[model samples]
Target: MAVTCCSVCAIQQLVSPYSAELSNGMQMAFLFALFTSAFCREAAKECRRRKKEYIKCLESRVAVLEVQNKKLIEELETLKDICSSKTD
Candidate 1:
């Protein structure tokens, strides 16, 4: 009857808008997830690159210090020989 028809119309109006809103929300969520994943990947790559550079710098510094220590030992030995000769 007229009551049935009115109820059907009301249901259609409410359901249609809700369906469209749900579809739009899903699309936005998908886009956000995609962008966030990309950002995280790029950040990880940058961190690895910086870590490699830091390791290289540290190795070079250690090599220089080792060279300096060897030169100091040689100089100390020469000074010791000179002092011993003077004492004799």
Candidate 2:
């Protein structure tokens, strides 16, 4: 009857209005709504956790690619110098 969370309180208010008429049906519906709310809360937390891990993986890959790109650029410059010396 006394719900602390604003969201849950709102749900209870919505359900309470119909409680007298619905009786057992209202109780079942309220329980189902609560279960769904808790499940969604947990699912959202899990999604955030997975998103953070994916971002970390992408950052690591970007760092590795940057290092490899620098090495390739240096090698290209070295080859250019060698070619110019042979031509001279």
Query: By TM-score, who's the top model here?
Result: 2
| Each candidate: RMSD | 16.0, 5.4
**Model 2: residues >4 Å from true position, as ranges?**
1-22
Q: Give the least accurate 10-residue stretch of model 1, judged by summed lDDT.
A: 1-10
lDDT of each: 0.74, 0.83
Q: After superposition on all CA atoms, how large is the RMSD of candidate 2? A: 5.4
Report the C-alpha displacement of residue 6, candidate 2, in angstroms: 23
Off by over 4 Å in 1: 1-22
Tens digit per residue, CA lDDT, model 1, 1-88:
1235755465456456556556767655654565556567878988999999999999999999999999999999999999999999
Which digits, one per residue and each the tens of the lDDT, describe model 2 over residues 1-88? Answer: 3345985666677778778878787677876788688778878999999999999999999999999999999999999999999999
Clashing pairs in 1: none
